[model samples]
Target: MVIKGLKHDAVAYNTMIGGFCRIGEVGKAEEFFREMGLSGVESSCVTFEHLISGYCQIGDVDSALLLYKDMCRKGLRPEGLTVDVVIRGLCGEKRVSEALEFLGVAMRNHEIAPKRKSYEFLIKGLCQEGRTEEALKLQAEMVGKGFEPNSEIYSAFIDANTKQGNDELAGMLKKEMAETQMPKKQE
Candidate 1:
């Protein structure tokens, strides 16, 4: 298209890359991304996000992580979706600990706020992995971040604690759930 005098701006390049990625041609997407860089078109956060999502969709989370680090090094702040994609990919790989750690670092250092769903995925993965203590801690952190714990999350924790004979903690979670579900009085 540029050969025909169509200006190959970042948006045009990003569209081509995104199209290739959507069709499962991540290799071609990477090629176009590199070519875009060579053509002096600055890559946007959206460009990196497309490639990150493409790598994650293929279960190539390592590549996605590398791309994430590269994006960070380039000083392009990742959007919430970008962080969520990488976190979800990590959880899908059963690397829930890594996901949690990454999320913590991103939140503390980069100030990236995760979507509630990302926390839910990590918590579920942790519970499935029998890391109930860590899951409880994560749930507390999520609450501290102002995310309300949904029933599914509460139930998962309750189930885990109950099965482990931690009735006290399970009861506490139930009480907390009830409190969260209560409607607050308007000031």
Candidate 2:
């Protein structure tokens, strides 16, 4: 296509790569990336983000991190969403510690603070790993950030404490559960 001048640009390659990744055709996506490299078409941050996210979706942390490092080496700093994908993927893979480490790396490397969803993922992962205290601490942090813990997060903490026979904690959580704010009826 470049030879014919029909579509010779990074956007075209990025779009094709994104399409292939979204359709779960990761191998083809990788092939396209390699082809872009061979064709002298530089990969954009979007392209790296897509490929790293695809690898993460497949639970391929090693590959994802390799891609992340390569992107850093190329001076292309990953955005918040890139970090979010890898963090969520790590949690899904039951690697909460690794996920936390990755979160730290993102903070240190990019100086980018995570959003609420990122904290949610880490809290849930911590709960799943039987670290309710850590989860609750994370919840406190979220609250400090002006984001109240959702019902699901509260429930997870309650469940975790209950399983460990921590009735006091459960009681506290139950007491603090979100109160329904019904609207007043008009006269």
Candidate 3:
């Protein structure tokens, strides 16, 4: 297209980047992204999103983080999906603490309103690491923000509490789950 002198806009650039990323050609995608910027095409959130997702998919979380920082430096406010991608990638890498910290900064700056899934992922990760107290605290914060934890998250908390000999807390969570009609934990 560039050879034909076709005018490429942000959407066209984003499409090319997304295509390359989909095929796991993140380097090419990044190349085109840079070209898009140099061509005076204004990069939108979608542009950054495609590249960020590509980096994350390739397990280059540091690159993804750097890209996120670049996006912020460009005054581009990240959307929920962007934040979710980074958070999920961090969690997948077992960097749950960093994910939580990033989320805190983003929320405090009013940059993004995290979806319930993000919290759930963090909660699950924390529970898996036996950080039950922190997980419970995060769940409480999620509830205070009007987001209901799902059955799996409740199950994790219950299991973690039970394993730690906090049977009373586990029972209380089970009762709350029942009241909310959440499915019972599988034996």
Candidate 4:
């Protein structure tokens, strides 16, 4: 296209970057990302999201975080999936504290709210790290935001309640879990 005097736009760059990232060719994708800017195409949130996902997919959470900060510096509000993937990556790396901080900063302040799945990931991370109180608070906030806890969340709540000797809440969650899992009777 350069030979034909057609400059690559954001769409073309995004496609190439996403394609490379999907194929485990993040290096290639980064090359295209650099070329995109050199060609004067503005990088959008989708572009950063794809590259960040590629980094996270390859266990390069640090690079992904750097990219995330860069995106923020450029005034782009990352999409929900981007936040979710980053949280997953940080949690997977056993960096729950850092992930929590990121969630507080990026996800909390972003224009598009992170998905419930993102909250679930953070809750699981906090639970795994034995930070039950913080996890409970996060779960409470999640509930207040109109997000229903999933099975895993129920398990977390049950454990926390039991540890705190709050048998009432534990039993309630148990009953709720049972109710949710019960099959409906046919007429």
Per-residue alpha-carbon lDDT of model 4 for 135-170, expressed as tens digits? 989988988989978898888778767877889988
Off by over 4 Å in 1: 158-187
With a 3 Å backbone cut-off (N, CA, C), the pairs that clash in candidate 2 are: none
Q: What is the alpha-carbon lDDT for the whole of candidate 1?
A: 0.90
Clashing residue pairs in all predictions, respectively, total: 0, 0, 0, 0
TM-score-better candidate, 1 vs 3: 3
The order by descending TM-score is 2, 3, 4, 1
TM-score of each: 0.82, 0.89, 0.85, 0.84
* Model 4 TM-score, all chains together: 0.84
* TM-score (C-alpha, index-matched) for candidate 3: 0.85
lDDT of each: 0.90, 0.85, 0.89, 0.88
Off by over 4 Å in 4: 2-5, 156-175, 183-187
Candidate 2 Cα RMSD after full superposition onto the native fold (Å):
2.5
Best of the candidates, lDDT: 1
Residue 54, candidate 1: Cα error in Å is 1.1
Tell me the tens digit of each residue's lDDT in model 3 across 114-183. 8888988899889878898899899899899899887889888988888888999999999998888755
What residue pairs are clashing in model 4? none
Quote the positional error of residue 146 for candidate 2 in Å.
2.2
Residue-level error in angstroms, candidate 3, position 52: 1.2
Q: What lDDT is reached at residue 104 by model 3?
A: 92
